[model samples]
Target chain A: MSGAFYLATRYMRRHRGKTAVMVAAVTLTLLLPLAVTVLVRAYDRQLGERAAATPMVVGAAGNRYDLVLQALYFRAGRVGTVPASLADDAERDGMAVGIPLHVRYTAQDAPVVGTDLAEYAAFRGLTVAEGDWPRMLGQAVLGHDAAERLGLGPGDTLTTDQQNLYNLARNMPLRLRVVGVLAPTHSPDDRAVFVSLRTCWLIGGHGHGHAPEIHDDEALHRAARLAVEVTEDNVDSFHFHGDMDALPLSAVIVLPDSDKSRTILTARFNQATPGVQALDPPTVMDELMGLVFRVKRFFDANFALVLLATGLLLGLVVTLSLKLRTAERRTLHLLGCGRWLIVQTQAIELGLVLGLSAALACGLAGALTLLAPRWLGV
Target chain B: MIELTDVRFRYDASASGAFELRVDRLALGAGSRTAVVGPSGSGKTTLLHLIAGILTPVQGRVVVNQEELGGLPDAQRRRARLRSMGMVFQDIQLLDYLSVRDNILLPYRLGGGLVLDREAKDRAESLANRVGLGDKLGRAIDKLSQGERQRVAICRALIARPELLLADEPTSALDADTARATLNLVFELAEETGTTLVVLTHDPSVLERFDRVVHVDGGGVS
Candidate 1:
C-alpha cells in the first residue's frame, strides 16, 4: 500500500466509531439512488414482459387494471365477470384461440385460477414436475411456489379460504385435492393454483356431485346444504341447473394469428358490447406502468435532492474530521512531516470511504435487481 | 554546545509586556547539565523554545552545536532540530493512535536525515528497555500508566540519539519518588549517551545535580 493509504487506514482503524459513521453515511447515500433505479427498471421489465407474452385479454367492461392483473397475475378481486360463452364466441372466429380464466377466489392465501387445462398449460409453457393436471372437479394443479408454500402435493387435500362471512348464499368454501405441480416459469403463474373451469364452478356452488333424483327431503336438503367434492361414482351427478352459457368467467386470453383478426376481434367487443371488453394486454399494461413510472420519476427527483443534501453533509463531515485531526497534524508538522502529507492522508481516507460505499451500493443494486420481482411481486 | 547573544522575543505585537523576553549572553560547555529555574510566567519556557529553534528570536543569534539557528530557513531549522535535539514537554504528547514502538520510531519516520531501519528499531528497543518500557513497546499509549507514559516520552525523545536533550517540567505531574526516579533515569541516559542536558523545572530541589543554574524573572534571563 501507498504511504498515505497506510497512514489513513491506521488512523481510520484507530478512530473506529467515526469511521463507521462516515461509512454508514456514504453507504446510505449511494444506496437510495442505486436501489431505486434498479428496482424501477426491473419492475418495468417484469410488467412489460408479462404483458407482451400474452397478446390480448377479454374481460368484463370495468377496471382495466383489475382485468390485466386477474388475467395475467391470477389475482382474485371483486371485478365483474362475463359469461363463459364469450370464450366460444371468440373461438368461433377461427383465427384466434380463446382460453378461459375464472379468478374469483383463493385457497391458503394464494389465488386459485380456473382455466382450460391444455390451452393454459400450453400457452404458459408449463411442464409438469409431478403428477397429472387437474381433470376432475375439486382437483387442483399447483404452481411451483404455490405447491412449495402450501406444502401439499399429489393426493393431498386442502380447503379454500372462506370467501364471505356475512353472505351464506354465495359460494361456501370447498375441499380440493392437489393433483399436480408445475415447474417454475419465473412468472406470476408460479404463485397461483390452477383448476379446470368445471371444478371452479363446483367450488363456487354452481355445480355439485349429488344424485340427480332427490327421492326424499333429507337427500334434497343434503344436496342443497353443501357443494359436493367430486368422486368417481358421483362425477356423473355433477351438473349446473342454469343455462350453461350464463356461467361466469373472469376473462379470456386470446392469441390471434393475424393482426387483422386481432383488430377485428378487439373492435367487435367495443363499448357497445356491455359487460365485455377486448384489448391488448401489453398496451393496457403499458398504460398502467406509465402511471407507476411517473411516480418513480417523482421519487427519482426526490432522491436527487437527497443526494445533494447528503453531499453537503459529507463535505461538512470532512471538514470536521480535518479540524478534529488538527492536533495530530501539528504534532506531525513539528516532527518534520511535510504539510502536503497531512492533507493527502485525509484525502486518502475519504477515497477509501467512497470506494467502499460504491462497492456496497453496487451490491445492493444487484440484489434489488435479482430479488425485487420475487419479494415485491412486480 | 549552546550560545545565545542578546536574544530578544515578543509573542504579541507590542514589544514591552510580560510576554517579552530578553536574554543576555549565555554559554554552556559540551556535555554540561544546566537547570533553568524560574517562577511562573518568567519566560523560562520561551527561552528554552528559542534555544531549541522552535521559535525565532527577533534580534539575536542563538547557536546550537555551532550552527546559527536564526540564519537557517524554517525547513532547514526543522531539520537541524530533528538531527541535533530531543525534547520532552510537560504534557506528554504521545500519539494515542500509534503503538509505543511506532511513537518512538516517529522521528525516523519523519525522515529528516533519519531513516527507519534495523539499527533505528534496535536503538528504540534498547532505549525502551533501558527505561523499563520493554513490554509496553507494542502497547498503545492509553494503556500505559502515567509513569510508564512519561518513560515512553523520554524514550521517544532519546530514540534519535541527538546531541542535545531538553526536558521541560518532565516530572511536575509525578509523585516525589517517581519524580526523583524519572530525573535520575534522564540523568543516567544523558550520561550514557553523552548528550548535553538542559532541564527546566520549577522545583528547586531538583537543581542540585546540575553543574549550572540559570534563573529567569521579570522578562530577563540571568
Candidate 2:
C-alpha cells in the first residue's frame, strides 16, 4: 500500500503538465452545471419571494398572464378597469383598498405609472430611500430602477406623453415634478413611476384638449371648465375635441374587501359587465412558473446528461493514457512494484484530480451565484 | 538464510509443454555470497524472483529466515520482501520522476515513517561515492547515463541494509572496468553488512568471484 501511494505521487509529479490540463478540464466541466444550478435556484427563490409577498392581485380576466404582467410587472397592454363604485364598496367593508391608476405612457421607453399614494404602501412594500412621497396631483415618485434609468432625482421634473408611442394622434405632455425616490425592492415596484390618481385623470383629460393653461391662477379656472370630466358615473367618457380616445390608461388595480366581496365583485363584473374581467394573481403566477419550470427541467436534464458523458470520456482518456505507459509499468514491476500496486497508483492519481476539480468548481459556482443579480441588474 | 527444495514452476496450465523448474535442494547461509549462472531460457531470473518473493513456484518449499515463503499470503510475502530483501534489476528500474537521492530513499518512505537510519544514509552516500555517482544525487533519473543510473540502483539496493540482497545482471549495462568495480563494491558492502548475496548472471566472469556457483539449464539446477 505504501508502495502504491509513493508510485501515485511519482506518476503525478512525472506528468504534471498533463495532470494540470486534466484538472482544468474537469473543473470547467463541473463548473458549468454548478453555475447553472445556482442561477436557476436563485431565480426560483426570487420568484417564490415575489409570489409570497403579494397576498392577492386584481386584474382583467382575459389572458391572465397579460393581466398579471401589466398589474404586477407594469408591462402594459391590459385594457380593463373596475368601477370606482367597487373600490368605494371595498373601503366601506373595511378592506385596505389600493387603486392602481395605470397610465402606460413612456418617456424614452421607460413606463410612467399614475397611481394613488396608498399604492406605494399597499402592493409594493416600498420605503423612502430619499425625499418624500408625492404630495399633489403633478408631483411624482420614482422607483429605484426608474430613477437610475431616467437620471432623475428629487427636485427634478419629468414630462410624460399623452399617449403611447404608436398612437396615431398626438397631444400635450404632462410636466411632473419628482418628489421622492424609492429604495431597492427587488420587485417590479423598483421599475415603476408613481404619481397621484388625479394626475392620471389630468393626463387623460389633456388628450381631449382639456389641459389647463399655465397662466397662473387666472387661467386655471377658465381651463377647468374646458377640461374633460372624470366623474365616477362616466369615468370612460372622453370629450372628442382632441385625441381623447388616446388616453394612456392600460389597466386598473383593484383590491376586494373580503372573500364574499371578491366573489361578489368578480361575479358582477364578469357575468353582467360589458368589457372587463377580474383575475386571481397567485393562480396566474403559478401557471407561469409551471411553464418555466418545465422548460428549465428539460434543459437541466440535458445538461446533466452532457456532464455524465464528459465524465465518462475523461475516465476513458485517463485509462487509455495509463495503458499507453505500459513500458513504464513494466519497469516499475521489475523494480519490485507489484502489478496491483501500479494499478492502484493510477486510480489514486485520477481520484485526486477529480476531487480537487469538484471542490474548485463548487467555489466558482457559489461566487457566480452571489454576483449574478448585481451583474444582470435583476 | 535462504532454502529451496525440489521447486517446480510452470508459466502455462498444460500438464505437458509447461515451463517447469526442478531444484533438488539449495541453501545459502547468512553472510554468504553465491552466484547463479545460466544461458538464455535457463530460468536463472525465475530462480532469483522466487527467492526474492516476486514469484511463487507452483510446487516448492522455499524458506527465507525460517518463514515459509510458499505458505505465506500475498501480503505477507510483500512485507517480507520489503523488510528483508533488496533487488537490483538488469535494466536499473529507477523511477523517472524522482531524483537519485529520492529513489534511494524509496524503501524508507514505503515503510511508513520508519526513518532511514543515519548510518544507512552514510553508507549509501559512501557507496555512491565509490561508484562515482557522488555528484548526481539530485539529478533526475532520465538525466543520468545508463552506467550512472545503474550505480544509483546499486546504492538504492544497499540503502536498506537488508538481510538478503538479490542482483539480476547488475553489471550487464556497464563497461568491463566499471562492472568489475561495481561487483567488488557490492561484495564488500554485503560483507560489511553481513547480507547474504545472490547474483544471477549469464556472464561467466561473475561466477569466478562468488564463493559458490550454481548453473541452471532447462529449469533445473546442474
Candidate 3:
C-alpha cells in the first residue's frame, strides 16, 4: 500500500498539468462552501461578540433591530433618540455604568461618535495607535481604518460634514482637529471618528460663543457665525443653555453589574416607556442571525448540489482513467502486483487529488476568515 | 530450478479454441540457458507466464526453485513469482514514472518478501553499474533510448536474484545488432548470477546461442 501511494504521487507529479487542473477544480468546489461557512461563521461570531460586549442597550423604542444596530453598530437611521438625562437616570442607582452616545454627525463620511472618551475606550477596548486621546472639546480621534481611508493623522484637521444641504437655516459645520488614531479592532469602531459630547452639542446649535452681548441681533448672528471653529482662545466662550442632562443622546449603553440589574432595567423599560426601549444586544443579534441562517440555508443546498455534481464528475474521470490504464494494469499484474495492489495504486492517485483539494480548501477558508472583516465590514 | 508437468491453461478467449497451452513436461537445470522458439500466438508467451506462475494451470503442477506455485493463493503466488522468477516483457514494461533505479528495485518493493535492506540496495546499485546504467540510476525511463530501456529491464529482472529468469521476445523490437547485444547481456548476467534463463524467441539466429532449444507448434511443446 505504501509503495502504491508512492507510485501514485510519482504519477501525479509526472502529469502535473492534469493533477493541477483536478486539484484546482476540486479546490474551488470545496472552497466555495468552506469559505462561505468560515466567513459567515466569522461574521456571525463577530456580530455576537460585539453585541455581547454591550450587555444592555437603551434607545428610542421604534424598532428593536434598528435600535440594536444603532446602539451596537452606530448605523445611521431616522430612528428617534433618547435624552442624555436617561443615561444619568440609569447610572444614578450605581447598578450599571451608563454611557451616552450622540451619533448625529459625520466627518469626511466617517461617523462622528460623540462619547465620553474614557468610558467608550474602556467599553470598546480601544488603545491609541498614535498620538494621544482627545483632551479638549474641539479635538477628535480617528479610528484605525478611518484614519487610513481619509489619509489623516495626528495634528490634521477635518471639517464636520454639512448637516443641512437643503436647509439654509441650519447650523454651520464645525472644524475638528485630529488628535489621535485608534488601533484597529476589526469592529464598527474602526470606521468611526470619536469626539466629545460637548462638541456634538456645539454642532447641534445647543451652544455658541460670544465676546459680549451687543445691541443688534445682526451682531449676535455674526458672533454665532464666528464660533464655528472652536479653539483654545475661544474655549471659555463655549457654553450651553438649559439643563445639560436634557441634552439629546442617540442611545445609552448600560453595562449592568449583575444579571438581576440587567433584567430589572430591561423590565423597567420594556414597553413601559412611551418611546424608549432597553434590551439586551445579544438577544437582538440572535434574531438577526436567525434571519441570516435562512439565507445561508439556500447557499448550503446549492453547495451540496455542487458537491454532488463534482463527485459524479470525479467518478466519471476515475472510470475513464481505469479504462485507459488497462494495459498498465496488465503490466503491473505481470510485475507481480495482485488485484488488491492494482486497486490500491488507483486509489492512491485519487486520494492524493482529494488530499490536495482538502488542504487548498482549508487555506481558502483561513484567508476568508482573516479578510472577511475588511471586505464585508461586519 | 524450473519445471512444469501436465500443464493445461487457456484464456477465456480460448473457449472457442483461439489460444491454449499444454506443456506435458519441461525441465531446466540451474544456471542453464534454454530458448523456446515459436511464431506469434503459438503459446510461447503463455508458456513463459505459466512457468513464471503469473498464470495457473487448469490442473497441473508448476514448480520454481522446488516451491509449488499452482495451488498457492493469489498473494502467495504473486510473492513466489516475484521472489523466484523474474520476467522481461516484449515491450520492456518499465514504469515511466519511476526513475531507472526505482524501476530496477520495483520487484523488491512489490514482492514484500525481499527486504530492501542495505544488501538489496547494494545489489541493485551494482547491477545498474554492470548494465552501464549506474550514471543513469536516477534518470526517468523516458529519458533513455530503446537499448538503454532494454538494459534497464534486464537489470530489473536480475535485481531480485531469482533462480529462474523469463524473457518474452525481449529483443524482437530492437535492431539486429542491439538484439544480439541485449541477449548477450542477458546471457552473461544470468551466467554470472547462476540463474536458469528461459528465453522465448522467434528469431532463430539468437536460438543457436542457447544450449537447448524447444520448438512449439499449436498447443503443445516439442
Q: Per-model i-RMS in Å?
A: 2.4, 3.3, 1.4
lDDT leader? 3
Please give, for residues B95-174, the per-residue lDDT of candidate 3 as tens digits: 88789988898887665477777888898899999988899999989999999999999988888888889999899889
lDDT at A81 for candidate 2?
55
Instruction: Report the lDDT tens digits of candidate 3 across residue range A252-321.
Output: 8998889888887777777566788887889999999999888999999999999999999999988997
Q: Give candidate 3's error at residue A135 in angstroms.
A: 3.1
Q: Arrange candidates by TM-score, highest first: which order?
A: 1, 3, 2
Can you list the residue pairs that collide in candidate 2? A61-A277
Query: On residues B1-222, what C-alpha lDDT tens digit does candidate 2 reach at each position?
Result: 899988888778644467777888999888889999888777898898889777898887899999889898876777677678888988777778888887887767554233667876777677777778888877888898777888788778877768999999888888888788778878887888899999987778567778899889988886
Per-model TM-score, in order, reads: 0.88, 0.74, 0.82
**Model 2: iRMSD?**
3.3
A227, model 3: CA deviation in Å?
15
Predicted complex 1: CAPRI docking category? acceptable
Q: How much TM-score does chain B earn in each model?
A: 0.96, 0.91, 0.94
Task: Chain A only: list TM-scores of all candidates.
Answer: 0.92, 0.71, 0.81
